[model samples]
Target: MAYTLHNLPAKLEASKMATLGYARVSTQDQHLTGQLEALKAAGAETIYREKISGARADRPQLAKLMAALQPGDTVIVTKLDRLGRSTRELLDLIQRIGDARASFRSLGDPLWDTSSSQGRLLSTLLAAIAEFERDLIRERTGDGRKRAMADGIKFGRKPKLSDFQRAEAIKRRAAGETLGAIAKSYAVDISTISRLRA
Candidate 1:
């Protein structure tokens, strides 16, 4: 069924299952007319459009479309890249639609549609590949971290006090100076001085 922006809410309220569309453009200069027309031609009753990078996870319109999903609803996009840049992110979005008892379809990439058996099989394979990619990234990151640590590279926040200042703070504490006094002298927190072992 064809729907315009004016009657979209009324149509949505009347139908239990709706064909929802999402169209995205990475930059303000990009045109959404093509995607919008394609989605409308594909029988999308309500189209959500956003001008934002697919790499960003905090897309407001996409979030709204996801929230508006109902059981047996179908979410259609012109292309897979229009939905997300990364395979993991696309799979995750599709999984969320499935969790909501809805399905996804890509007009440009027919094999990515989740409403068919072939598409489901391809999604399963893609999910496996995404998992493998994540594992490789984790392994590489862990190895790099280990190498950096072995080379004396420190991670996390820098120490607030230098070694000399720390030693002096401990000595001052042992000599009966108040933590507040030591902390004020070093321009550090009182908790920092209190944690120093004498």
Candidate 2:
């Protein structure tokens, strides 16, 4: 390669162009293929697909798509729910896209695009409502957990060992044996054995 400013014209980097498509499904039986087909019909240059719970936040594929977005580009999804299980997260993602100088379009909902005045207004209003709902859920969940704790209702998974099993485990531990060996015999964790001894 030779730097020739005399005869050859100076080359400039091309402007960024991007249109990403996102598809999601709630179950194994719910095929994402239909969403993909619809996205393609909507003229998406790239596609991202995933199978996860709507309530899950750690979607690696969605993160990748967001990272790859460019200014003047768009993020297209079959629907708003496909973008997120949480209302606030969905609103945050759309806001981020706007901050990135990009846009969002939904195949199902006509209010996503900011082209029309009504569409733009609806987008902002809906995003606000979603954010409010998410906050309310968080507050309610915290309050409910606190109430349950006061009422002596334990949250999360229950202990697998009964009081009788715990007594037997204590006896086994007192008889001289490795916790691992005891656990192997009973098919339980060493921590479980330690708790029993305690």
Candidate 3:
């Protein structure tokens, strides 16, 4: 569907003056004041604030607000990213709002809301672009890693003991030294000594 906020139901009719605002901050130290201020500027009322990671799909307050929203209510957020940074999540939420016959608007990103036809279309396109960007990043990373591995680029920490040290361990073991003694002498794990010997 050509997503546009105008095509979506305006939960609050033009007659309704109040807009419900939702603000989220992923960290406790981060304040929601800025978001609230922006929402208020956008003519929102009764702003609900939560300090929780948008990465978390289940947010109690946000869910409750969505559920409690009436047809005449418009949900306002400070930014599209505030609602959700993930494309899948944003799209799913907008779809849910449609089912609930509610409206949505964002103050930050232009591709923010689904309360207007243009906004909805922009939102959908933005979400798809985000998803595409993520996929491309993953693909590039995988290819780069593969190329690196092929170039004999080693990863992780180097072994504590050198070849000479390892050879000495084998000689000591052959000379009847216990694995524990050998491990303790070399300051290495018992499993490491055992594996080296094996």
Candidate 4:
């Protein structure tokens, strides 16, 4: 089914929902005319446009659109990809919209319309799959880290001082040299010299 404004749920129609539009281009040189026209024709009362990469987490216009959403509001995008860079990102954005008591629609992707029953079901399924994929990746990363640790692979930042330098620092500390003086000699922090053990 074509999830157009006319076909929106009766509850939404009765509430006099606002149709907000978002249009984005990846770069400054890219044009937003096509997207703007489509959104206008689709009955978008307010349109938000941005010239920024979808991969970026910070989108000022998108942020404003999200903040402007009200209960029963519908956010329309020219395409799903224009809204998010990946499926996970798209799902997260939709979930946020749902949390705001609003809905989302993509003029280019009918299955993404949350106003329809079928679209809601598909979106829920996709969200579950994305969550499962994230869990699997986390599990794999943990397992790999454990294996590397078992092989004596060290993690985190390397020790700042060499073994000889560490011993010398400890000796100097034991000999009543000030931590600041020892640190100055080695060009290391006073905390590093203070942390040295005999």
Model 4 residue pairs with clashes = none
lDDT of 2 by residue, 1-198 (tens): 111112322242125456778888877778887888898888776688887777777877788888877788888898989996766678788888888888888889987785467766887898878778879999999999999999999988987787887787788889888889878877888887887754
lDDT of each: 0.87, 0.78, 0.77, 0.88
Best by lDDT: 4
Better of 1 and 3 by TM-score: 1
Better of 2 and 4 by lDDT: 4
Which pairs in model 2 have colliding backbones? Answer: none
* Residue 1 C-alpha lDDT in model 3: 9
> What CA RMSD would candidate 2 show?
8.7
Tens digits of per-residue lDDT for model 3, 117-170: 988788678778878988999999999999999999977799878899999999
Worst 10 residues of 2 by lDDT: 1-10
Model 4 per-residue lDDT at 8:
57
Q: Which ten residues in a row have the lowest lDDT in candidate 1?
A: 1-10
Each prediction's number of clashing residue pairs: 0, 0, 16, 0
Q: After superposition, how far is residue 104 of candidate 1 from its true place, in Å?
A: 0.8
Per-residue error at 22 for model 3, in Å?
A: 1.8
Candidate number with greatest TM-score = 4
What RMSD does model 1 have?
Answer: 3.1
Q: After superposition, how far is residue 169 of candidate 1 from its true place, in Å?
A: 1.3
Identify the runs in model 2 with alpha carbons over 4 angstroms from their true place.
Answer: 1-16, 130-198
How would you encode candidate 4's per-residue C-alpha lDDT over 16-114 as one tens digit per residue?
878989999999999988998899898887788988999899998898889878899999999999998999989999999999999999999888899
Please, what is the TM-score per model?
A: 0.84, 0.58, 0.56, 0.87
